[model samples]
Target: MALTGETSTQLALRDPDIRLMLRVRDDDAEAFAELVELYHHRLVTVMHHLVGNAEEAEDLAQEVFLRVYRGRKKYHPKAKFSTWLYTIANNLALNILRTRQRKPTIPLNVRDSGPLGPRPAEQLVLDRHAQPEDRIQQQELAAVVKQALETLNERQRIAVVLNKFEDMNYAEIAEVMGLTTKAVKSLLSRARDNLRVVLQDYIHMNEPGQERKDEG
Candidate 1:
């Protein structure tokens, strides 16, 4: 069962990472490293998907830690440790995207504009087919899906990534994005719609191929 607000707050207070963060507030260097060790890969992976580049994602993840360290003295358990961490990440990513928006060098959003209104294809490979994909095919499909993600507006991209990649629910995504759950739902709806259109050919390929007829 999901925890209630009070229970969640209480749990957050008791969480090991929260404890570690508390220690960090006391200038415990080891606590800082522990927090990084715990969240580094997860943050990097999520940021990588968001930014569509490993190097940028790594830089962003490090920045998150730096901000966390600097703000440790003011740390308060407003939410779970993970939720707080993601909030920082969300802010940094928005800044990067906004900067990109003003730059002529960066490619802007690549939305799928067509007649296809959305169907759920949040994770392209998983949603497109029921049969299991072999390693190579899955990798190829993942690359396509990653490209599809870049097409979304930044908010939708963040929402979809949190929902699909992190397995976060609408509420969690809302918290991370600082939006309402309803807003998160709308974002994900639009994102999935876009993904469906972009990956339409691949999805169709996953279906049983039509048999050839020998017409005489």
Candidate 2:
């Protein structure tokens, strides 16, 4: 059968594992393990952005999952599954930031050499007619832009990450962060403005010359 939104949502809502989660409310062990497998990595990635360290992020993520398992019996479907999951992530991340008493830092110079590599700007330089020197300058400019994003407040940072990286729309971000759509838009607008200012030099420097345009 073709999946309709209602049907798909119902299936997830009444999923065997979610049903198992219902069982977990009654104190089922196996059901909890199933929940763990489903959300662990996703939770970790969200937390890593909030906490800014892989190890502490992983630890905090585990705690959030554990809270879910413990609270399963009381689980209610007031929101979508992902929404509820992100609510947990957001709360945990906020708590971590508050307790640690450290300002958020975005590491501009850090190269993405890991299994999952850098942002597109870092990985791809679209200089059609520029020489190698120009490409090097563009890469440095991209790094500065990335760093500026890091300096934004936590809400703005999260909003940018979800909207840009995860492709979430305004409503989805509002749901995830418990903000209004207007608020989400404001956050993104501010972030974009900050990024534009931070990368102004790069933008001006990289503008296509009239010769290049004429050729096209």
How large is the C-alpha RMSD of every model relative to the true structure? 9.1, 9.7
Residue-by-residue lDDT tens digits, candidate 2, 1-216: 112355534755655554556666778787778777877877787677656678987898888888887667677555456566677777777666666646434443455544465643433333323443456454555455555665567787778777775567888888888889999899999988866755544565556551233344
Best of the candidates, lDDT: 1
lDDT of 1 at 6: 58
Give candidate 1's error at residue 154 in angstroms: 0.3
CA lDDT, every prediction? 0.78, 0.66
lDDT of 2 at 72: 74
Lowest summed lDDT across 10 adjacent residues in model 2 is found at 120-129
Residue-level lDDT tens digits of model 1 in 1-216: 124565534765678888888889899999899999999999999999998889999999999999999988888776778888898999999999778757635432344223353322444434446553443365566677676877788899888888877889998888888889898888889889987887776674455452223323
The deviation in Å at residue 139 for candidate 1 is 5.2
TM-score per candidate, chains pooled: 0.75, 0.64
Number of the predicted model whose TM-score against the real structure is largest: 1
Q: Please give the distance, in angstroms, between residue 84's alpha carbon in candidate 2 and its true position after superposition.
A: 0.6
